[model samples]
Target: MSTVKIEKGQAFWLADPQEHDFPAAYDYLELLFVPEECKAFVDKLRGATTIKKKSKDILRASALPLLPDTNCHVKENLRKIKKKEKLSPILLVRANGKLIIADGYHRLCASYYFTEDLDVPCRLV
Candidate 1:
């Protein structure tokens, strides 16, 4: 996965701005008509909804910066992370008002690859 570094006081969703195109490659895996196994998996997702989450409220591309010092090649693992990218839109839940990464770690990394940023879309619940 793309290296990630969290900084203080920055709530941003680094994303693949390319997603603005709505690429077919990004659709196949998340399509509702996919295989039975896939459908079952989708069904298990938390808080599935048709409502469009506010994009403005979410973080944008360009938060994460390049890795420091080491130049290790972790591309293969990163590719795998991208393939499993979720469409259900990971939720950052709060039990008593603490932010958490409920899901979408891969998407977070993928966002970094597409944009040198490490921020990612998040929903507070």
Candidate 2:
């Protein structure tokens, strides 16, 4: 199953920044596609649409590239999520009508690999 039902819209969550495993160097580039952009974009999208979608569907909206190879971090996140350790909601941004993953790509990949029906919580900016 996919996450979003269509190509023109998406779902997301939004709020002030909270530190995670995200690398510090990302702060500089955050203005682009990483985290900051998602928040900014979502805030702009506010009130324009209200959408909810499954994890797999959201991934389809992103059209993100495959990881190519699993890293120790991704493998660990997969194990944890499979075991029911709740992960933080993913962060996403809209650009040219496409959902860009600003964070939680690994977690998304893991969830999709196991089940497309997973409810992925996200914050869109």
Candidate 3:
């Protein structure tokens, strides 16, 4: 079998889906994404791992910190905040640079008004 390797220092990039694959995607919003409030606050979160070699390393191998998901109300506020602040696409921090969110899909469909996309920076630890 030929092995397809995910290079070191690379992350599995997922976009903010503009259109969900399912018709009933919003039927169970809570189950799709976890609430941020439920997470425990960590005093110190570790930084991203720097790649030294060509070997592949799964991110789960390291203890990563989780940033809270934006809430429904706050998500709406992001839209207003974006208009007022003139914020750019959401920036997700990486060990190398930032990932720009091409879209804030859920917001567009009125699944939830506002944006959790504003001022939110994310990094996979």
Best by TM-score: 2
How far off is residue 83 in model 2, in Å?
4.0
lDDT of each: 0.36, 0.55, 0.25
Off by over 4 Å in 3: 1-4, 21-24, 30-125
C-alpha RMSD between model 2 and the true structure: 8.3
Write one digit per residue (lDDT tens) for candidate 2, span 2-118.
222222222222332335523422442266665766445544533223334577788788887645226665676665654555555666666668776766787677666555676
Please provide, for model 3 over 1-125, each residue's C-alpha lDDT reduced to its tens digit, 9 standing for 90 to 100: 11123334332223321123221222232243343311211101113222221111111222222212255643553444444432212211222242211222332222112221212222222
The better candidate by lDDT, 1 or 3, is 1
lDDT of 2: 0.55
What is the Å distance of residue 13 in model 1 from its true position?
A: 13
Ranking by TM-score: 2, 1, 3
Model 3 poorest 10 in a row by lDDT: 37-46
